[model samples]
Target: MLAVLLVTSCTSSSASGEQGDDAKPRSTSSARPAPPRKPVALTIAPGDRAAGVEPGAPVTIAAVDGKVTQVLVVNEAGQPVAGVLSPDATTWQTTEPLGFGKTYTATATGRGTDGKDATVTSVFSTAAPRVKADLSMNPLDGQVVGVGQPLAFYFDAPVANKAAAQQAIQVHSEPAAEGAFYWYSDKEVHWRPKEYWAAGTRITINASIYGRDFGNGVYGNDSRTAVVTVGDAVVANADGATHQMTVTVNGAVVRTIPISMGKPGHETPVGTYVVMSEHTDYTMDSSTYGVPADAANGYRTTVAVASRMSNSGIFYHSAPWSVGDQGHRNVSHGCINMTTENARWLQSISNKGDVIVVQNSGGPVLESWDGLGDWQVPWDQWAAGGKK
Candidate 1:
């Protein structure tokens, strides 16, 4: 009867959900809470630790899922590189440019949401080119050029990657002028507006080519800058049929001058020309254009005022010898000869880039690449970014 009573008591305790001997206790610590989250992870770029990175490109360290505390980049010589940190403290970047083909180390630290700390380190290197080409440009700083002047650049080496090299240059003009670049050769380029620059336009050109790749294992060695201002517009129109020349300054007819152009056999080139230079007292030599000094059409003389218009020895100079035929006929070799007074006036008001338009001259069109003859190319052809 006692055994029956014990079994019945055990069954009663099970039904009431009461703990019994040999039964596990219902403690509150049965399932432990999940462990705290891990700290933020660090990532560094230039994925491979090799010598193929651009020195100017940003070397960045970034953290994810948390916030970064600090970052440091140092060269092989233990020099600390200058860098800028983000406002959110999640990223850092090196500001000071790195040296080519040099080793560098980047170390970053971050903290997790649950107060845990983490750190990461990376090693990388920059590119080293076989040749570092430098750049030079025209329309130098502080010079006042004419409205038709083009900003020219001459690379020290031929650029195989012409597109990349062209893109590295930035040109900005005050009052905004639309322009494009044209390549005369592999190493020479020029930039010009669709039309002549307005009077008083200011232009600044910057070549940010340092550490940039220019193809064929060549890179840029340095940067360059040029600032130029456009002065007044001086345009001269000479007509072979009328035997007259009219000059304009900033859209107004400034003066009219009687002139004698090249004779029938040696008519002046019938196209646009730019005045390359001017001189007060200059020598005129027909031999310079391949004519013999003692030949029938060749003569050597001095002029009081001469303005050079072409590389092939074209000029407009004071010719007291031709003054009698100036307003009536064309009787010079291949130059536009005018009175001394008119030549001096033309020289005084003209800049290096001034324009001279010759009409009905019965000669071949002026060839581009002839003494600042950039205006000969059509805009569509120029905008094609030649040799790219």
Candidate 2:
């Protein structure tokens, strides 16, 4: 009985060994192959489901181990956002900034070297602006102005980002007026052509500031436009040494009149100027121009036929007291003094932007910022001032 049991045990052991060997071969042959790996991957910036993103933040989509095939970005209204694809077609980014408190979606597709495709979609929202600035323009719509008139903008609030603010404003002219924008102050900016505007030229300014960020949580409220038409060229040439004033219309000398300029200590400024305003009767105050009324050579008198030619209290007005000096010698406080009849006639024919060139004066040249002295700046310097 013991011998029989031993033989049976041996047979069972052999059978178990055979089964183990067979199972090992079956497991090796029937094991599932590893899942195929993806050939391309896409990544969207700001990530999917992002919130409170800055409106000026850049939005981009990039491909990995592949090239971008297509990309589309749209706002909540389904309007497509403008963007540019990379030259190699590996990435895409938005061109303009997004609006505040707005939701945007981006979808991108890419193809791998293995001929497989991959896609990704992202959604995000921009934060609302805490402060906003509004802008207004001068020259009024459809107004006819003189060649020396400047295109100016006034901001309701001070702009910290002057570069960005200037970028939002664009100026265009019919015959291509080359100009530059000069920031006179925090809230004011002015633009003037390299030279005076050609007669009958059309000027337009487009201020696309809406949705533009100006730093420190400040954004632009709305956009604006200003259009102006240039009229005939009226120029006045004054010779301080000869005490003569010549008026020209479209390059033709229309009239010449005797005039008296500044005395020795109060010589007139030489350079180009523009007529700012006209007044049938105006009071001349020495205090207004920084000269105290109690000081020597200071006078406060009311006069007829006055035309404001500068911000520093300079004018072309009647000064009958100095009639003997007219056309003979320069003797007056610092103005172009003429007969009442001639002053009235000149005032009647001149408009707000007429050019006035003062030559052969003893004083320094007029400053470019002194009441429409933009013509005093050279074209190269003016253009360089606008470089970003």
Candidate 3:
């Protein structure tokens, strides 16, 4: 009986040990649940760390399976690049062209359907230009000019892509004027309305050519703006046959001065012209106009109240020596000879761009490319010359 009890106790103890082992807890530290995934994907053009990008290249940022919340693009100078975002908020793109040799940074934020946010960043640089073209404008900013004034641009280098160059310039005028740009040569262009600009017109020119490529390793250097105000319309009518000049301000005759024009061989040109410049005193030298001082018809003298009417050295000036021929016959070289008082009065009232019309002259008609004689070109011809 003692041996049976001992064996039984040993069995019970073994069973109890087994039970204890089975009841003990097992560790779950090695097993874990996976993390949630990002809901949005971001893409940027001219991708991160990109180089040698074109200035006019497109810049864009887009989000997939999500909506774009914010985007910011800036240059090294910290100026914000102008851009527009789609209404659905999926993409954003730049509006204006970028500058050459500039480093730009872009940052974007997006939100996913799961309410998670994603942010992305990119840095890039534009290619530098080997050559650059600079612009020089006429009728400079903030000046009040006459009706016949034209907006002119002179490029430092010849532009091979005339159409592209013309597209870079924009003009806006208050009171609404219809105009077109005419290329006089590869390096020069001018813009004018079909008729003279209306008095009280306000004009603005935006030359947004920076970064524009003009073939042959040339690019635009910078952008510019010009604002001009139009003053009264001062028009002068000169009759070579009658030898009289009628000056009018806004269609009302202001002065009728007896004048002497060019002689038979050196007759003044017919057609319209603009007053390019004025001087209180100017030296009229025959040599300046390719006429030798020793020639029979050549004369050199300094005169007061000289107003340049053409690029060919024609002027309306005070000529006391020709007083006898005034109002009767055409005398002197290809200039309007008038009394000192009349010439001074005309200069005092006339501003740059005033209209001067010479008629019934036995001379060649004015050429369109001659000294701001833009009106000489018909409206249809001028419009055809623009970016077609």
Instruction: Give me the candidate number with maximum lDDT.
Output: 3
Cα miss at 146, model 3 (Å)?
1.1
Better of 1 and 3 by lDDT: 3
C-alpha root-mean-square deviation, each candidate? 11.5, 16.1, 16.7
| lDDT of candidate 3 over 295-384, digit per residue (tens) | 987778999879988888889999999999999999879899999999999988888989999998788899877787888998999988
Which stretches of candidate 1 lie above 4 Å from their native place?
A: 1-45, 56-71, 83-96, 108-122, 292-296
Candidate 2 regions with alpha-carbon error over 4 angstroms: 1-131, 156-160, 185-187, 386-388
Residue 135 of model 1 has an lDDT of: 87
**Cα error of candidate 2 at position 292, Å:** 2.7
- By how many angstroms RMSD does model 3 differ from the true structure? 16.7
Question: How does each model score on lDDT?
Answer: 0.84, 0.82, 0.86
Candidate 3 weakest lDDT stretch, 10 residues: 1-10
Instruction: Order candidates by lDDT, high to low.
Output: 3, 1, 2
Clashing pairs in 2: none
**Residue range 181-274, candidate 1, lDDT tens digits:** 9999888888899999999998988888888888887888888888888889999999988899999999999998999988888988888888
How well does candidate 3 score on lDDT at residue 354? 92
- What does the lDDT read for residue 337 in candidate 2? 94
Cα TM-score per model: 0.79, 0.67, 0.79
lDDT of 1 at 348: 86
